[model samples]
Target: MFPFPPSLPPVATESAEDLAEQSEIEYGTLEGGSTMAFFRDSKIETYQKMWRYMESKRPSVFVPTIEEGVKRVLEGNYAFLMESTMLDYTIQRNCNLTQVGGLLNSNSYGIATPIGSPWRDKISLAILELQEKGIIQMLYSKWWKNTGDVCNRDEKNKDSKANALGVENIG
Candidate 1:
């Protein structure tokens, strides 16, 4: 989530390089813009590299917590790159913050069962059925998307479409 008052026009991107090269916006406009970003300060080398990239060319963009990053963003002129699940949760609760792109990367999770357990196949089949019928997606929309205390922004569909998912390394 990058900070832009709900009033301003969108400046969305999925690339960290784009944000830094283009400037998260010198101060809400691209004409004479410069980098305006925040890093997650992670131990992972990729994250460190990303942070260093921003710091080397731009002002430091590292923040220790989501609250700090979000606060910085809400103040205006910043991009908070982070793990998407948490960031997306925060976005759901606020109208001021919105994701501007598609997945920078992705991972999969699965249910676990005892080895050769009968329940394993049953659960997997059930999950697949739910997926094929779109029930899981519908449930996600109902709970994660709609069940939030957001501002009165546009109440549109809130699915992560396949575009630029934004700079994952930073957000």
Candidate 2:
């Protein structure tokens, strides 16, 4: 049997009601919506099984860098499926660019690889936008401060009260 990995953080505890609320929020359902009923309708069980199978292995085993992550996500079948689902969910919920940025940052592991030219250009633009807004920061590089200034301004605009919000506001 495999012991739980030390690198994994401790699981947070939640009540049944809290779990239900979290699921509703994640899936973009109204509180007490029929969405919970849909999950109990069997199709969700199949999807869960499929998801477990897909997530059984480490994506980093195949792709290594953020660029690779983008490439794989855009080109690979499995990555495409998951991305499509996420995209649909985001669209349905009317999520904004910041939400997309969070997804991109967290799900980079699934798509990390050497990205193609066109996609790289697009990602570069997104990065520039993200940087300008100060949602991301450059570190350990000579141009860090300069880049930070540009992105900090962008961050200010993207988040109206970013400076006033303090450390807790960071995603």
Candidate 3:
């Protein structure tokens, strides 16, 4: 287990292009393949997109697990491209790891069933019922928001404050 942040930032991440640019600079070469982590054989099209994009500049190092990604990131000079859920979960559990940029894409969570399975419709209906009854929302809040272990952010003055003048912020 890792220590959580005392207070969360107002924004989870910046623009994806910004993250890629910043990461490229960090690794000291935009043309040489930098190491980035991704779940092996991912079904996500965005994963393939990122790989292709990075590969055009430099070949990337893809890892199997989120933990491996986190490890590479903590070791410095690396970036991890993953789903927002996993990114958030990892960031919540580790103080040292933070999401760098905004979502590159959006996806919906789904319950999978074998094609043509008779139970699919029943399961889908059950899920819909739970969602309509607010059971799904309640469970989500309980696990992701009300866990009491994740950090809290104060969003009151988020938009009214002046941007801090800093080297990092300038780029």
Candidate 4:
């Protein structure tokens, strides 16, 4: 399960050259070997500086509700979700696949959940409402596509498909 709120790793104080050398030694790079040699020769402070620089590039994350979710989405607060595992997992659990699919299909707004549980239902309904607004679209699954149904029918169809293929008679 993803944590409710994600925590990023702290920036290390060590230098890039040191980090590179450590990475090289830990991976066992010989004197002339290609891989580790390059980083091993770099200054440790260089690596540390690079780490801090990258951390500084990250945008602050915010949690918003139905009233605020749309606004935040429009503002790009959920942009990190594109590459963040924690954010993705949280979205997956709180928002069903259909809702997320709809958001992806829509071009206007972004998606973000509120800080607590009270907003879960509201967020979900808001996504649906957003779809109605033409700002999003809730895509149905393959099964739903063919039959206009959302419930899984795998088990119901299993016996027929198996019998037709003669799998039931197999030893």
C-alpha lDDT score of every prediction, in listed order: 0.55, 0.30, 0.50, 0.29
lDDT of 3 by residue, 96-128 (tens): 655554444445777888999999999989999
Name the candidate that leads on lDDT. Answer: 1
TM-scores for every predicted model? 0.59, 0.19, 0.57, 0.16
Output the lDDT of residue 41, model 1: 38
Q: Poorest 10 consecutive residues of model 2 by lDDT?
A: 1-10
- Indicate the residue-level lDDT of 32 in model 1: 17
Candidate 2 C-alpha lDDT tens digits along 56-152: 4334323333234334433322122223233333223321211221211112322243756467667777777977977764432334344333222
Question: TM-score for model 3?
Answer: 0.57
Question: How many steric clashes between backbone atoms does each model show?
Answer: 13, 13, 4, 11
Give the 10-residue window scoring lowest on summed lDDT in candidate 4.
Answer: 97-106
Residue 56 lDDT in model 4? 48
The lDDT of model 2 is 0.30
